[model samples]
Target: MQFIDFKKEHFSHNKEAGHYFIQISKDEVGYGDLEVLEKQDDDTYSKARYELVDDVSKVTIKMKNPGNIRVSF
Candidate 1:
């Protein structure tokens, strides 16, 4: 599922002119590959899979069937 919230200031609109926030979350128990993409000038995307960091944070805990994770962008 996808959720998009935005505000527009004109009758004729441009998507780039709005301020918005997006939230994407899986609604079921799942494990999948996550890919990061870079947008190109001609409206195409380049996919990139980054290496997962092992020790970015000092805090560590064990989670079983975890339902929530926080990511800051």
Candidate 2:
């Protein structure tokens, strides 16, 4: 499970926009969830910050079953 965001003008809206992807087999549980927390154990990472520097127009999710999936941005 991961969120990929390309902060560039040339990447276009599709790739540039944040995308949360999770790959699972059909026979498996087929469930996933994503949450981007501001603080990581009372500390924040350099790349992942609470402040929003760039505006994300769209967020796409790719999964086999999205019924149990939740995304927090």
TM-score leader: 1
Query: Relative to the true structure, how large is the alpha-carbon lDDT of every model?
Result: 0.28, 0.30
For all predictions, the C-alpha RMSD in Å is 14.6, 12.5
Candidate 2's TM-score reads 0.22
The clash count for each model shown is 0, 0
Q: What is the C-alpha lDDT profile of model 2 across 3-67, one tens digit per residue?
A: 33322221222245343333323223223433423223434422232112221333333422212
Candidate 1 segments exceeding 4 Å error: 1-23, 28-30, 48-73
In model 2, which regions exceed 4 Å deviation? 1-56
Q: Whose lDDT is greatest here?
A: 2
